[model samples]
Target: MNRLVTVAEMTLRELVRRRGVLLLLLLMPLTFWLIRRDSHVGQSVRALLLGISWAVSTAALFATSAARELEPRLRLAGYRPHHLYLGRMLGLWALGLAVSVPFFLLTVFDANNLRYAGIAVAMLCCVAVAAPLGMLIGALLPREMEGTLLLLTVVAVQMLLDPTSSAAKLMPFWSSREIASWAVDHTDDGYLSRGVLHAAVVTALMLVTVAGLFGVRLRRRRHLRHAPLV
Candidate 1:
């Protein structure tokens, strides 16, 4: 418990110190809100919230602290890797939620509808979907540049083949049709059902991806540990 708490504190503080994370979490959302102020009220707010959530999750995964120092420092302090990873994941999720809530509230108030709750759920769904994807990318390509390029490629593909695109309809998270339909509906029934479905799918995918990444990391660590020393 103490180790997890320490890792969480350290992760949070490290996040605070990163200017890029700060800008992405704060300034970018504010800018989006200002720029889209004149647009359709509900849709604009939904888009802004989605963008902010996506950006924050992506940034958190990529903006890691110096891990080389981390292993030695933690070892010297007698901290376990599992504790550190758990704490870091907790901190990341907390930060993601912090950035998400304000935009959600803005959407709820501006839209002034119970359906806005669906929008909030959808945004969180997207974040859940994106975060593990980010972690998978991080694990596969540990180098920052490689991971970043991979992320950009994926983002590019997603943008080019959004839900409206025929190719994207097959993608789990990209199919925004249900959400879009519910967005047009004033009733909460379709909205809640579709939103919950999306959230469930995303949550499941995230869990699976996290498990895969953990397995890969564990295997690689074991291989390295057993390697003949020079």
Candidate 2:
């Protein structure tokens, strides 16, 4: 609908206008990739994936938080809750894809013998998981400070966890690591399958959560009934 597109376009414009934040978002993954460039090829790629995940999620959180007051007004002005959430989500996805492209090219140029398709898939999975996760966090925690601290804690645990542990799969970016393994090491089809499955499950759950919360938060009031005018 035109309403959805308008909200999405407005969200995109706001995100673009934050030039400094956009630069920092793009820089984080590049810096991470460089940090492990000398350590090991796989390390750098995995770090880059994680960086991308963190950057996208953080951006989503900020976007959702920044729009908290604006959304209710939009809902009052003929916009539905789903329209607001989905539009914002689409904008965030576009932003995430924009950020991921350069890093994907870097992997193509800097790394050797990588399954390029797998690398792209892993980055997609990272962005897919991160956007909803951030929106859900923003919905649940209204305060940006709290949402950010929680995201930092989650990212820290994700990086520190043993990949072989069952617990690792619970982390939002686990798919990034698994698919990165397949890309860099030419692992079996199992890695790709597991990564894809994990991403689907997490993305579905987060989207549902965001939808439910937004529906309730922006629902029309029961007590303040509007009667038809003569």
Candidate 3:
């Protein structure tokens, strides 16, 4: 238990040190505020939260502490790779929620819109889901430069594909535009039932997928250790 806490704290501190997390959690929000300064407060706030989620997800992927260090050092330290992976995910999720609270408060109280409150909640869930997904990618790829490229490629593909298109709606973190449109077309009661459920299911699936990949990596590492060298 103490080890898990230590790992989580270490992961958060490492993320903070990278500076990318700051840019994502701070600068991106500031950028949205600057560009949309004259826009309707509610709309601007919603856009701000969306932008924050995107940046946070990308930054989390690129700033993973585990990926930055050599696997040999990690194995040598007697750390359980799965625990370390889970701890990193836990830390990153906390960071995502930390950045999200301001956005939620802004939408709920300052923006004077309960709908945006729902949207904000949904976006926070997206960030929570995205953290492990990002970490899984980071673990598999491990190189920051390559991981960044891969993250960009995946985001680009998701944007182009529009998982919420008429055919499919199960993609992890379906974009804000899709959610907003659903909210507009259907009443809050109807949208909540469909949209929130979809989001929750997708989020759960993402976490599971990430855990599975981490398991696979750990198994491969153990297998390599037992194999005879040529």
Clash counts per candidate, in order, are 0, 0, 0
lDDT of residue 61 for candidate 2 = 95
lDDT of each: 0.60, 0.93, 0.63
lDDT of 1 by residue, 35-100 (tens): 767876545654465466456556655644245345446645776556655666667766677777
Candidate 3 ranges beyond 4 A from true positions: 33-46, 65-72, 108-110, 153-164, 167-170, 175-186, 220-230
Pairs with steric clashes in candidate 2: none
lDDT for 125 in candidate 1 is 62
Give the alpha carbon lDDT tens digit for every residue of 130-219 in model 3.
787677667667677787787666555554564447634544555444555443333446555565676677667767776787666654
Instruction: Show the colliding residue pairs in model 1.
Output: none
Q: What is the Cα root-mean-square deviation between model 2 and the actual structure?
A: 0.9
Candidate 1 Cα misplacement greater than 4 A, ranges:
68-82, 112-114, 159-191, 219-230
- Clashing residue pairs, backbone N/CA/C < 3 A, model 3: none
How far off is residue 20 in model 2, in Å?
0.9
Candidate 2 overall lDDT versus native? 0.93
RMSD to true structure for each model, in Å: 4.6, 0.9, 4.4
User: Between prediction 1 and prediction 3, which has the larger lDDT?
Assistant: 3
User: Compared with the true structure, what per-residue lDDT tens digits does model 2 show for residues 50-138?
Assistant: 99999999999999999999999999899999999999988888889989999999999998999999999999999999999999999
What are the models' TM-scores?
0.72, 0.98, 0.75
